[model samples]
Target: MSESLLHRCPVVPVVVIHDAAHALPLGEALLAGGITVAEITLRTAAGIGAIEALATALPELHVGAGSVLVAEHVDQVVDAGARFVVSPGLSVAVLARAQARGVAALPGVATSSELMTAVGLGVTEVKFFPAGLLGGPAAIRALAAPFTSMTFMPSGGVSADNMADYLAIPAVPAVSGSWMVDPGLLAEGRWDEVTARSAAAIRAARGSGAFQRVV
Candidate 1:
């Protein structure tokens, strides 16, 4: 199950949709570009609706909810039919609710302390937030060495140019970013551009020559 969530695509687009109307077409664009997974962040009111729409219309896509912080938020997203949930920081309340709901959870961590907290809670996968500011790939390499069995999803400041750098590390099975599905493009209804960028991102990740079977 984790493999299906994090291994199907090396790069998971962290998308923010302004309108629920664009969900299906956006998922199609990303799918056409060789990407079968995406995290539709709950940064706006449209977020839950988008997740429901995507989960219903494109069950083939691994639709996830992001920026989820509390138990209520978890309940909301899970009830909306989100297959997974992502948070900006580790929250036991959210994690517990997600677990109760049977949805995969990827909580964010910015330091070794938080990482340890995740490990203590039986988490094997997490998001290294603000990765670039925390030293990007280098930081994750150092921080992950101690855990030895964890896989990190590097987000924030992750981009096309630096994807290879993150993928170079065996611990990083996948990296999440919004470069391909920028909110502006969705706002403009630029479906073709979205598809092209998604395709280009996939090619870049595959050709980075840093990919390894993480699981």
Candidate 2:
């Protein structure tokens, strides 16, 4: 499940929806732009509802929960039809609960110790949060040196300008960020702009040789 989800798109848009009504259109816009996966964040009250709306109404758009912080949150998102769960940091309870519930968990790892913990938990994929602050793709390359079996998805600080850099690393199967689904664009209901950005991102990913690198 983790491999399938990661390979669906080289750029996973990290979305934060303030209104559930906008969920359907957003999903359609992404699909129109050639993106297949979205990480709807639990950063707002409408997040869970948005997840459910998209998951149920547009099953083709692989929906997942982001900014998930606890075991309970995992239950909430999985129940809402999230195919996967992402957190800002690794948590034993979160990973355990996700495994128990049969949902893929992509917990964040910013250090070698965290990566070790995730490995012990049987996690094969992880999100590298605040990628820029943590040294971006170079940091991921260094961190992945010993964990050759693990793949990474760089999240925070990821943007079109630097997404290619992240995808250039063989260990990075995908990159996640909110640039394609920026709050301002959503607030203004600029679905066209969203589609354009999403399409451009996909084009960039392909140009970066993401498909050739993904195993």
Candidate 3:
């Protein structure tokens, strides 16, 4: 991968768009807030269509697909124009499919075994899901010490309130969460609120000075 996902943007908005029509405006809102990349999860039926819509409407945004659980889902997402793939757990089949499709895969790793497995699979970066519940920054600190070359993106429970904490760790170049693009905000068509939250998240991450280079 020429550009690492974590470095593309300090905060990668994890969005669950209920309506495919909302994709364009949502992308615009994120871009307006200084965000250039985002992950549209497949938790809802509209996920794939949303990815396709955003891909066609906003070519500049580095859009990715999240909640990818199966290898078939990987194919579906790639066909929909997802530049990358994100999963909530480490799945060899899913990662392998992403590699075959020739896109970056940000698989989740909640334990050392999973991290090691990911390394063996040629993955350099991973998503630390349920981060706050899994000991948060402290856990990442301890887990990251063993893998000097690996980096992490803390997911669940990550917010502006604790984004700085995650960025403080040298291993974490960026963090992922839905606070900015929460489903509720999207459902309400609150584009302005989305932009505001996105801006605030970026400002918080930048304050840590950890966004030196994206790649």
Using lDDT as the measure, the top candidate is: 3
Q: Whole-model lDDT for model 2 versus the true structure?
A: 0.90
lDDT of 2 by residue, 51-81 (tens): 9999999999999999999899999999999
Q: Which digits, one per residue and each the tens of the lDDT, describe model 1 over residues 165-187? A: 88878888889999999889999
Q: Which pairs of residues have clashing backbones in candidate 3?
A: none
Candidate 3 TM-score over all chains jointly? 0.97
Per-model TM-score versus the true fold: 0.95, 0.96, 0.97
Each prediction's RMSD to truth:
1.6, 1.3, 1.2
Task: Return model 2's CA RMSD, one decimal.
Answer: 1.3
Residue runs of model 2 more than 4 Å from their true location after superposition: 1-4
Give each model's clash number: 0, 0, 0
Worst 10 residues of 3 by lDDT: 206-215
Q: Summarize candidate 3's per-residue lDDT along 25-128 as a digit string, tens digits.
A: 99999999989999999999999999999898999999999999999999999999999999999999998898899889999999999999988887899999
Query: Lowest summed-lDDT stretch of 10 residues in model 1?
Result: 206-215
Q: After superposition, how far is residue 185 of candidate 2 from its true place, in Å?
A: 0.7
Evaluate all candidate structures by whole-model CA lDDT and list the values in order. Answer: 0.87, 0.90, 0.91
Question: In terms of TM-score, how similar is model 1 to the real structure?
Answer: 0.95
